[model samples]
Target: MSIIQINLTIAQMLDYTMPILFAALCGVLSESAGVVNIGLDGIMRFGAFFGLLGAFFSHSPWIGLLFGIAIGCLVGALHAFITIRWNGDQTVSGVAINVIAVGLMTYLLEYVFSTTGYSPQIQNYFGAQAYRVHLPFLAKIPLLGAFSNLSFMIWFGFICTVLMHVLLYHTVLGLRIRTCGENPKAATTLGINVFRIRWFAVIVGAALAGIGGATLSISSFSGFSDSMPNGVGFIGLAAMIFGKWTPFGALGAALLFGTGQIVQSIIAVTGIAPKLAPGLTLILPYVLTLAVLAGFVGKSIAPAADGLPYYKEQR
Candidate 1:
C-alpha cells in the first residue's frame, strides 16, 4: 500500500480498537483477581443499552456514560453475589448473565421501542463528532499523527491500561488481590479477605466493561441497537487469555483484533471478492483467537484457583 493508504489504515485501526482495548482491560482486572468474568459480554450489552437510553432521555452523552457505569456496577454486584457469596459456578453465572442480557435487551427493544431489535435514532447522542487533538509539531508526522489522533475512548483505554498495570503490580491492594486469586487459603490465613477481594475485582471489572460498551454506543455508534456489542466481549476474553492476563499484552491483542476488523471492513468496501468476503471477514477474529489460544495454551499459566470457589470447610 502507498504511504497515505498505510496511514489511513493505521488511523482506521485506532478508531476501531478503543472498545476492544477497554474490554480487555476489564478482563485483566477481573481474571487477575481469580474471578472468571464470562459475563463480560452481558455487561457490555447492558452498558451499551443503558448508555443509549440515558443519552436518549437526558439529551447528554456524559450523563449516559454515568448511567451505564451504574448499570454495570449493579450487574457486577449480582454476578459477585451469585459467584462469590453463594458459591455458584463462575462459568454458569457468566453464561446466565449473557443469556439474561440478550433476552432483556431484545424484549425492551421490541416492546418498549416497538421495534424489532433496535431503538429509534435519537438526535441527542454521544460521539456524534470527531474529537481532534492538535499537537503542534506532532500532528505533522505521517503515520504517527494518523494513529495518535484518537477518540476520547481510545485515550481513556490507554490510560486505564497504565493504571491497571500499576495497580496490579504496585499497590498493597494489588498484592492482596493477587494473593487471593493465587492462594485463597493462604490469603485467608494471612487475614486477607478473599471474598471481598474477588467481589471488588469482579465489580470493578464489570464497571470497566460497562464503560467500554458505553464508548461503543455513545462515541463509536452514537446510537443504540440490540446486540450491538456483537462479539467484542468475546474478543476481549480472547485477548485477555492471549495477553496472559497482562494489561499491556491485552492491549496489544486488542489492537491486533481491531486492525483485523478494520481490514475486513476495507476489503468488503473494495468488493473484490464479494462472495467470499463476508464469511472470511466474519471469521478473521475467531481465527486469530484460536491461533492465540493454541499458541499459548500450554505455555501460559492461569491463577492457581481461577475457576474454583473457595469454601472454608472444604479446606
Candidate 2:
C-alpha cells in the first residue's frame, strides 16, 4: 500500500478504536472497584440514541454528549442500587440493564424519530470537516499523516487513556479503588467505604461508556442507527481482557482490534472480499477478539473480590 493509504488506514483504525478503547476503560474502572459490568453494550446503546436525540434537537454535539453522560449516570445508579445496595447478583443486574436498554431504545427510536432504523442526521457536527482538528505539518510525515485531520473525540480517547492510567496507578484514589477490588474486607478495616467507592467507580465508568456510545452517533457518524455501537462494547471487554485491565494495555488491544476492522474494510474496498466467502470478511474483528481472549484470558487474572457483593453489616 502507498504511504497515503497507510495513513488513511491508520486514521480509520483510530476511529474504529475509540469506542472499543472507551468500553475497555469502562471495564477497567468498574472491575477495579469490584464491580463486573456486562452491560457496557446496553449503556452504549442508551448513550448513542440519547446523544443523537440531544444533538438533533439542540444542534450541538456538546449538549448531546452531556445527555449521553446523564443517561449513563442514571443507568449506572440503577445498577449500583441493585448490586451494591441490595447485594444483588452483579451479573444479573448487568444483564437486566442490557435487556432494558435494547427494548427501551428500540421503542424510543420509533417513538421519537418515527423510524425503526436511524435517527435524523445532525449537520455541522464533529463528523464534518469544519470540526475536525487539522495538523497540517503532520500530513507529510508518513504515519504521522494519520493525525492531519481527525475528530476531537479521537484525541479525547487518547487523552482519556493517559488520564485513566494516571488515575489508576499514580494517585491515592487509584490505590484505594484497587484495594477495594482486591479486598473489600481489608478496605473496610482500613476505613474505606467500599460501597461508596464502588458506586462512584461504576457510575464514572458508565459515563465513559456513554461517551464511547455518543462518539458513534455524533462523531463517528452524523446520527444514530439501530445498529449503532454494533458490538463495540463487547469487543471492548475482550480488549480489556487482552490488555490485562491496564489503560495502556487496553489502548494497544483496541488498536489491534481496530486494525482488524480497518483491514476488513480495506479488503472489501479492494475487491478482495468477493474472493472470500460471504460474511467471512465481516467477522475479522470478532475473530481477532476471540483469538486474543483465548490466548490471554486464562493467563490474566481479575481482582480477587471482583463481582462479589460487599455486605459490611453482615460481618
Candidate 3:
C-alpha cells in the first residue's frame, strides 16, 4: 500500500527468490550440457536429508553442507550412468531417481533416527547471523538492510549465478558443452567428448541443487523434514523454461515465481478474499508460467540432442 510496505515486500520476495534461483541455475547448466535433468527434485531431497544428517551428527551446519554436496554428486553420477551410459530414457531415469530418493530418504530416516516423518531440530543450523554483512549505506536503508543480512548460501547462490553465466558463455569448456548439446554428432567430429561434458554438467548441476536444498534445511528451516524442499525443485524447472535457459534470465524468472509464493502466504495470513485467495495464491505460479509461455510464443528450443543418448557408431 505504501512505499515502505512495497520495499518490505520486495525484500521478502528476494529472500524467497534465492533458493529457487540456485535450483534454476542448476537446471540451466544440465540442460545446456545436453542432459534434461528432471531429477532436480530428487537431488534436492538428497541434499536436504544429508544436510540434516550431517548437521545432526557432526553438530555443525558446515559439515551438513559438505555432506549434502557429496550426496548430490553421487546422485548425479547415478543419473549419468543410467541415462548416459546405459542409454536409458532421460525422463524415465529422472522420474526413477525421484521415486528412489523419496523411498531412500524415508528408509534412512527411519533406520537412523527411528523417526517416521522428520528429523529432530538441529541446534547448530545455518542462519542469517552466519553470513551477515554490514554494507555502510545499504544497511542504513530500511528495507535494503534486509538484503545485507542474507544467509550465507543466498550469497553463494548469487555468486554462482554470475559464475555460471561466465562459465556458460566465456570458456572453451563452455563452447564444448554447448556444442555437445546442440549436436552430439558434430561435437564428436570436433573431438569433443560429449559424454564427459554431459556428465560434468549433471554433477555440477546436482551439486548446486544440493546447495539449494541445504539452504532450505540448514539455513532456512534449521532442520529437515520429509517435504523440506516443498516442490521448489519443480518450480526451478519451470523457471528454467520461462527463462529460456539463461542463468540471469532464470534468476529473474525465479524471483517472479518466488514473489508469487510469498504473496500467496501473505494473503492467506491476512485472511483477505478468503476462499478465492487460497486457490489463486496456490495456482498463481503455474498460472503465471502459462502466461509467460503463451506471451513468449516461440518455438521452445531445448538442446538439439537433449534427452537423447549418445552411442559411438560401429565402423
Which number leads on lDDT?
Answer: 2
> Looking at model 1, which ten-residue stretch has the lowest summed lDDT?
126-135
Write down the TM-score for model 3. Answer: 0.91
For model 2, the stretches where C-alpha displacement exceeds 4 angstroms are: 269-274, 278-298, 313-315
- For residue 125, model 2's alpha carbon misses the true position, in angstroms, by 2.3
lDDT against true structure, model 2: 0.87
lDDT to native, each model: 0.81, 0.87, 0.81
Clashes of each: 0, 0, 0
* Superposed Cα deviation of residue 108, candidate 2 (Å): 0.9
TM-score versus the correct structure, for each prediction: 0.90, 0.94, 0.91
Candidate 2 lDDT tens digits, 1-315: 688877888788888899999999999999999999999999999998998888889888889889989988888888889999999999999899888888999899999979988887889567789889999999989899889999988999999999999999999999999999999999999999999999999999999999999998998889998976788989898888778888998999889888776766677666665565546655765666666557643456778999999878666
Which has the better TM-score: candidate 2, or candidate 3? 2
Q: What is the C-alpha RMSD of each candidate to the true structure, in Å?
A: 2.5, 2.0, 2.5
